[model samples]
Target: MKDPIATMKSFNRQFQLGKPEIEAVEWAWPQEQGETMFHIINVYTKAAQFPRLTAESGYRLQRVGGMILGMVN
Candidate 1:
């Protein structure tokens, strides 16, 4: 993704439409070892929705060479 933030924002907007399961979407780009990291946080209302969200997000990110570090509560 040439513009990771923009890409994610677009994805978030599309994903959140009519989806009460998701509360919020946040992201951060922190520099680590001279490389920028893309971190995404999806706040969801239902625990059951987490896996699907995570999987979809991971899949999208992976297409741009991004990886999920892990999930945090």
Candidate 2:
């Protein structure tokens, strides 16, 4: 699909150290089909601000009897 949203959602892969999963998406611009757009995934923008937010949430590291909690995803 040529749709940017679809391409982004299809990218369910690890990015860096945190293994952050993009569960939800919110864009500042109106997303219209067949409309040319410029998308930026950067720390300066909210679309790319998930990592810092998740980190600040203070998720606990779960350790049990060989059952590790997966924060990624």
Candidate 3:
């Protein structure tokens, strides 16, 4: 199985969109001092094999609520 982290990196390196599109890959993690924390996951790239690559990777985290919410390539 392939690694999700490595795959994400590779996908990012291979895919090339406009500057605005490329900027969407950034993620923001919340930092709450006393309350709770939140993280926003946003990925933008053009990889047709992304789904298949992730599927074969046995990514259990995806089922546990970690979502690939926004994808624009």
Instruction: Please tell me which predicted candidate would have the highest lDDT against the true structure.
Output: 1
Candidate 3 per-residue C-alpha lDDT over 1-73 given as tens digits, one digit per residue, 9 for 90 to 100 = 1344444445445543333332333221112111111122222222212333344222332321133342422
C-alpha-based local distance difference test score of model 3: 0.30
What clash pairs does model 1 have?
none
Candidate rank order under TM-score:
2, 1, 3
Candidate 3 regions off by >4 Å? 17-23, 28-42, 45-73
Q: Which portions of model 1 miss their true places by more than 4 Å?
A: 17-73
* TM-score, candidate number 2: 0.31
* Model 3 / residue 72 / CA error / Å: 16
TM-score of 3: 0.26
Q: Could you list the CA RMSD of all candidates, in the order they appear?
A: 9.7, 11.9, 13.1
TM-score of each: 0.28, 0.31, 0.26
Root-mean-square deviation of Cα positions for candidate 3 versus the true structure, in angstroms: 13.1
Sort by lDDT, best first. Answer: 1, 3, 2
Per-residue alpha-carbon lDDT of model 1 for 1-73, expressed as tens digits? 3565565455556554324222213312332111222334322222223344556554443333222223222
Which residue pairs clash in candidate 2?
none
